[model samples]
Target: MQSTYQTAALNDDYYYSDILYSPYQTLPPVIQDTLLDRQRIIVIANNPSITQAKLEALLQPTDMLVLFNDFIHAEFFAYHPSAKDLPKLLFFRQNGDSLLHFGLPPRSNNLTAILEMTKHATLGMLFGNTDYQFPLPSDDPRPNDDPITANRVLEIPKPLDKLLRSQEHCGVLSEQHSVVADYPVFADIHSSAPTSGFLLYRLLLAACLEVQQQKNADTPISIVMLGFNNENKTANFWEGHNWAFERQELATPPHGVEIIRQY
Candidate 1:
């Protein structure tokens, strides 16, 4: 049977600096095994900071994909920053009789379509927002630039909500007001100043841990970090001597939620 996902080029208008992947040698043996054995791939754009070039580069190698875009979906909630100028990641996948379209908000029926797409995959990745807050414009007139408190509980789109709910194992890391009850609530970084790169790292780490527990020993889970810079701490963390397959304590915001792992 044909796979449900495929890779395509990024839109011409999008700009980016570079594309980086975790060297296969750097990853844990099991994770490396999973990537090579199951061919499961996860792609994430934690924030708008990522460039289109990098996003496309990650997709070139995988058939199973996940994209996260807080900007396009901002309309559902009241407080996300405007991403009008940003170039969106676009790609297509064959789903049964129709093509599964991505890079934009899906129509209500599209949610069911997305859920169907997930059924055939062994590993999954989440993209877009991870509960981190961005700074508001200096001249912006909102009474409170900090939207986390003002827009704490966002009712996610029905399709996306359903998709998240249906997942057997999931991980969430957001501010106090940002709630995702379906999955294991990992770190709660309530601060308004954290960078998207750091948030992506935490989310993927948590997601991988959750996946490890649920999947068999041979299953592999690979995370794609989009719009990444070499200087970001996550890049350093992966390359650092301290990195290990064993779960390590994650540095979280004040009053951060904690997760216990089987690893």
Candidate 2:
């Protein structure tokens, strides 16, 4: 039982005005409805232009736990009295540099914790970059000195793992040249450019679609692509390109994930 929802048209001035710039106190009803209905939700933002004020404003309404790429962004919510008071507003930092620099409270970096968070996340946004290394502690000696390794590893969680595994292993946009992972769920995009944000957004969408299809779930999934500007003006790898959501006939891939692209 697959159903389609339409995102508001993008304004010419802003990259994602309908979503990123929408009023915080009263978000679009569609967004509210989807949040209420969906079993799984993932929001991806990589736009460097996004400010602390904007992020905090958007987060004010939800009880979602956020996984930030660095302490720069995580600190706002992590330290704010209001944010701290919300027991549901948990945060995790993926960047070891920030973790080591700030010396914040440690949270479990185990795969089990990640899986549990993904399964239960009411509203989640993952920032790209910050170099998400996995299965290794943030304080690991190897990454301490030479943070940007000649070779890097990108980790994919279980929910996303299931979705990517269903595809034909096209390399991710980021690690295209590197040795790809042998497993269907893991592979490198092999590019030096910063494309993780875009890739993360795509993967999150794919994962949500896969879950809905496989589970025969009827709840609607709403996606807001934050920080993508016209002409790929942002630092994301896909420069000179712009993406928008256009209404089209719903088409499901072999993996049973339906994707809606701009016409």
**Best candidate, TM-score-wise?**
2
Superposed on all Cα atoms, model 1 deviates from the true structure by an RMSD in Å of 17.9
TM-score of 1: 0.31
Q: Model 2, residue 28: displacement in angstroms? A: 30
lDDT of 2 by residue, 83-128 (tens): 4423221123233234321111122223333334333322222222
For model 2, the superposed segments whose C-alpha errors exceed 4 Å read 1-48, 60-68, 81-194, 232-263
Task: Please give the CA lDDT of all the candidate structures.
Answer: 0.30, 0.32
Q: How big is the positional error of residue 263 in model 2, measured in Å on the Cα after superposition?
A: 25
| Residue 212 Cα positional deviation in candidate 2, in Å, after optimal superposition | 2.3
lDDT, residue 135, candidate 2: 36
Clashing pairs in 2: 172-189, 174-191, 175-188, 175-189, 175-190, 176-189, 176-190, 176-191, 177-190
For residues 1-263, could you state the per-residue lDDT of candidate 1 as single tens digits? 11111000012222112211222222223333444433433344334454444433434334333344332223311211222212122122111121121222221122323333333333232223231122123322332422333333333456445444433223222322111112222244222222333334343333343344445433325544433333344422422222221122222211112221111
Candidate 1: regions farther than 4 A off: 1-57, 60-172, 176-193, 230-263
In candidate 2, clashing pairs total 9
